[model samples]
Target: MLLNLPCTIAPRWRRLALMTLLLSGLGTSHVHAFVLDWSQVTWNTGSPSQTFSDVQGSGIDISISTTLAGGFYNTPTQDNNQNLNLFPDWYSNNGASSYIDVTIRFTRTVTNVSFSFEDMDRGNISGSRPTRYYWEDVIERANGWNGSSLVTPTATDVGSNILIDTTSRPGDVLYRGNTNLNWSPDGSFTLNWEQPVDTVSFRYSSGSRAQSNPAAQVIGISNISFHSAVPEAGTLWLGAFLLAALALRSIPRVPELLRIRTRSVSENS
Candidate 1:
């Protein structure tokens, strides 16, 4: 009795088919998460020292002096000595200036972001009670990219007692969000951003309500999380093109493969 078998692909052909499948699966839906830290910061002059840098996986940098009048001090400390934190770094600002601005510049463009915040005073070390922290307004703003870096956005006080206002500044103001009231670190609050941003700035203490003494108020942040959206199909398209090119290059070898098969069949006969 004679038997017939269906045609089969060679090992190389099987590999090529697998590559095509993988290339098809590389869709544009991708996102990356980066936990903020002092190590990633490209520090400029007049920036604070690395005490905050001792906190691994989380940190924040504050400008000692800006075009505005206020200054900030940052140190690494856990909230109430608890595990819940946005980052280990905490800070306090004091000056005649109504608000203090903290800016975060990303190495990559980010479309979506979410971060947790606490407004308790570290001065109360018992961690059982909220300290004497007062605030009139808390605001956030984003600036567009000018090439690879963010353009310096202008920030003006909205009112007589207002702090830095990015809305009145030089660069394109892409997004804004704010909360009204005195913010303290007794608990945690998180902010999520829908607009894409290259740099993010947080305005603390608006409404002309600076600390009573401008020397007493303390503000603490636990951790910051950043999300980045992958660029549209450009990468996917490039991969698909490369795969198609490889498949075309293999076509010329197909005839050579058939000749070897034919020669094997003749020997069997």
Candidate 2:
């Protein structure tokens, strides 16, 4: 008797299970929010200013500020700092004795960020590994909007400042040596946060007190990549609710089917 009852509802039960499986799957994955192509991105700059338009496909409201001594410049032929084109553009410290501060601001919040560095002045010397240099950096985050500035950063405008080593390993600096000049082969740092961020700043400086190489003062900023996370919880729940309603709609038909089965059994008897 139990076997016969299950056979009567088997098709409906299978349909309900399939629907639930698909709807619940929505809760398990993430979607990409944005990707910035530096070459295609818009740009505007003045003596102490630089703007990256439409970053992360959000209409390009991001901005960067350099010290009076630091500013933006493009390589002779290449544009779009997205990757290592033969000729690339860059933002530099412009001979600042101290670290050059580059502050980045976004009109919308960003969740994950990856910054790429290209060598504008590493000597012509080619090697199996990236040479070590004297470089240091600090990355900080903020909640609201802030203008670019060369002045000292404040806690009100910037969140906690996290210092990061320039080298891939300890006791060393200027450390990436891959020859590809492409994004992955170059030097880069990435940050992932559970919370959204509106502002990010980087302070950079490299060189020894005795050395006067122009490359030491000039750091190449090759590209910028950032993205926001998509919201999926609502979709998951909505799908589940609709699927549940569909299963309920199937329940009423079960009684009609049972009545037909019982009538046939009586007729046979």
Candidate 3:
């Protein structure tokens, strides 16, 4: 049942309508999560704070800030900044602990969100195996640790990926964090939440002792990835309608289409 229109659509508008509809459909159909590409992430060697927005073209911002210099970041070659490398960290001064927090936040709530804290181990580069004893951390819940249990997994306490404490540390209470597994080889320890989360952040301190000035420890955070919520079919259709409406609005009005006739007269006449 074709209904004839009183006025013909402009030729340019016909083409514009077709293109708008096509582009809108393509945008909605191809939405997927991309592992945040770090190739574009850039910062000075030791800038205490930085924020990289819309990473890998994803709707997320990855931020790092610290009290002391040399907080958290990749070396020229990304020595221990995520990407499965050992996560290098800041240190502890006890009263003046060098604290660093890497927070990944999405502007809108999203799902399938997950990332990891890699090489949650410690070192002095001194002993046979030294640990980040004064180190503590919390995931999403600051200062929420319950027990005070502390363990030095290695007798000499110098190694990578070793569990500092056996009990009360694994289940996520938040920490200045002395107790959590290293979770290396790409993800034995990860923050994989089944439900959606808008913000994912972890804070950690580093130092072999509390009284002395802060030193460097090692840790890593994996590439955060998540899928954007796909719009409903109804929503897509409505969007398409709006695009077509925009095209229609761009069409020339009836008065604008009118051509006024003009008569030419000679200047001498």
Candidate 4:
């Protein structure tokens, strides 16, 4: 008849053995880690003299300034240096729109990407629903590259479908209503989006409503970046298993060496 081992002892030994196997596997498999590198870029637009630099690809920065119209008492001014104006219906009156476009390049493949826009401020210009912000992700078509026809994925604000609406007010932040829109005291806004696209192009429109005086415009971007996720748990486990197998193969000789040492010790005694 065989004697039974203690229940506590068996479980403890099994756990230790299992942990060793797991760690060995982790050491064998090669895993890649990704980090965002956003250290070269700059943007500035309009008055209040705003500027931004060293932006990441996954993030964005924005700036805005107001101006007074000429000869008219309290008439809105336009920032002519960057061709941007802050008054209502400015784009329509000037026959032009104020905007900025940034192109970002990627070397490796990225599956899922998250984007954030910062410093979207319209100031304290209270009026009937002034649409001052627009954001979208532009991707190149898989087919041939056309200078004019670049494929654009549909962008949704909050949960509502997004359209070129100039009637959106400062308080109205979401493209739909389900997304979070944070407003800062300095007249800035932040918006985030999650989309899987190969190439990303950011377009900003400021004074697109004016037709005649289309000089005043203001806009900026910063903190643009992207990162790849680490490998899943299965990958790590497989690595551990391979390492454990190697470890076991070397274990057979350990007992023999121990036995030889025991004999040598006895002989010396």
Candidate 5:
């Protein structure tokens, strides 16, 4: 339903009502994609540091923490959120595995968000059938390629990493790469989604031995990209209604219009 305009409004003001209805479209708020930008941020680095604060970028904020003894976060080396060091590692072998949790919060709900999981070849606890997993989402791109390392789908060590069983948990990811401590310079894949999303995360765990950890434990993430969210249907409707109402109120009633015309005619006579 819309704002009900009085039918008795003078005919001269009908155009005003029409314009008000059209102006309501402005409330839709068609916004463009917002890529996370970190060129202005200044962050520190440590392998599971004692403490690190959250960082903010264009249209987004990021928080990184750990439940175990090792984790890492670095400011991007390049602009537009490139080369961000969000990898995982462990310093102590207290019978616990390595874990890292990264949560990216958007200023508002966005659609089709995504990022990259890079340099996941091997880790400190590399061994046969090691328990390793990483969780991510919101974009579509093939694995085995990051920029410098992977070229073809059949490239060496392309499918070396085996995906573990995650049927029970859809958000879980299992990976078992080759024995090489550092397989490729940039062995990685991407997860993309096309629907509406507000917040996304990256959670990782590994049973690789803490004593022999390598560069493989350093998993970098590319900048996330997504379009802005649209307003809800109710909000759009209400805005349109109010605009129409205000416009109609300024219109003179039929009697007032008639009196003005009559006065003009008498003066001419």
Candidate 6:
């Protein structure tokens, strides 16, 4: 004698199959759900360097300066002298050789922030000129902060600030050379040792004079921008789909089995 399976099992199985399909589709879509909110600022100056405040609030500030050729003083022969003093009130230094101090003030507490820089100008030079620049964000941890204790991001390679090759043609946008800081996003990007901070400073120079011209000028940097990190809608949908699928999978088997048995008895009767 052959026993017939309950018809209710067919409907339950179809539901499970449908749920699996929907979940799979959702997961696939979620894999591509990522958003990047980036902004940039540029700075140039006729003086050795200049500083600007309220970059993130009013809008990113771009500073430009004239490139001084044949200024490479050491092993690096290519030196394009253009500096943007990120912190003029607090720190002072020679051009392109020392760290340019920057201050970040936050109204609220924050944890992480990312920064990117671009070489707006490069001196006309050739052959292995070491052009170096760096971006750093200093954080104030307590009151009456001294020096160096301020937390800063990893320094980029020298002559490669914002990681753009000045020797290369021009108009090259390089993101690798910039500094990226990870902290809570609830605070501002300003430097206020009493509070929190997320700021960026830059430095650049050529390696050799043979690789640059004393009168050569280098320039290029578009913008620097920032935004809060929020997951894409697809991510939310995928999460919901997975939750639904898991819930469906977790349904008590006993109830389903009982339903199937009742359906069978009713059909036979």
Q: What lDDT tens digits, residue by residue, belong to model 2 across residues 67-141?
A: 422333342222544542222122332223434456677776665554544442233332332343222222222
> Which regions in candidate 3 have their CA more than 4 angstroms from the true location?
1-31, 59-77, 80-98, 124-188, 207-215, 232-235, 238-269
List the candidate 4 regions with Cα displacement exceeding 4 Å.
1-99, 110-186, 194-198, 206-208, 230-241, 244-269
lDDT per residue as tens, model 1, 27-144: 5566656554433443343332222231223232222222223433342333443322221111223222544555555554565555544542222222232343333334444333
- lDDT string for model 3 (1-269, tens) is 01112234445676776777665765464456756644445555645456777766665665544433335544322343455332334533442235554444556555556665555543233342253343433232222111232211112222344344424446434322334444445222455443455555555554333324333445555565667655557767777777777777777666644421111122223
Give the Cα lDDT of each candidate: 0.42, 0.45, 0.46, 0.34, 0.45, 0.33
lDDT of 6 at 176: 27
Q: Which stretches of candidate 5 lie over 4 Å from their true place?
A: 1-17, 37-40, 47-60, 66-81, 86-97, 123-164, 167-171, 175-186, 207-216, 230-246, 249-269
Residue 185, model 5: Cα distance from true site in angstroms? 8.4
User: Using TM-score as the measure, which candidate wins?
Assistant: 5
Model 6 clash tally, residue pairs? 63
Error of 4 at 197 (Å): 4.7
Cα deviation in Å at residue 58, candidate 2?
Answer: 5.5
- TM-scores of the models, in the order given: 0.43, 0.44, 0.47, 0.34, 0.52, 0.30
Tens digits of per-residue lDDT, candidate 6, 1-269, equal: 01444343456567777777766655452111111122232333234433444444433332322222223211111123222222211121122332222333322223333332224222222234344222222221112112323444432322322333333324322222232222212111221122223333333332222221233222222122233223356766876877676667656488666766776687788
lDDT by residue (1-269, candidate 4, tens digit) is: 01122342355456657777666555463333232322332223223333232123322322222322231112223232221222222332211133333344344333333343332333322243344222221111111112333333333232122223424443222221111132222322223223333345544433322223333333323233344433456867776676567556544365655665676667668
**Residue 171 deviation, candidate 1, in Å?**
15
Number of the predicted model whose lDDT against the real structure is largest:
3
Clashing pairs counted in every model = 14, 6, 14, 55, 10, 63
TM-score of 5: 0.52
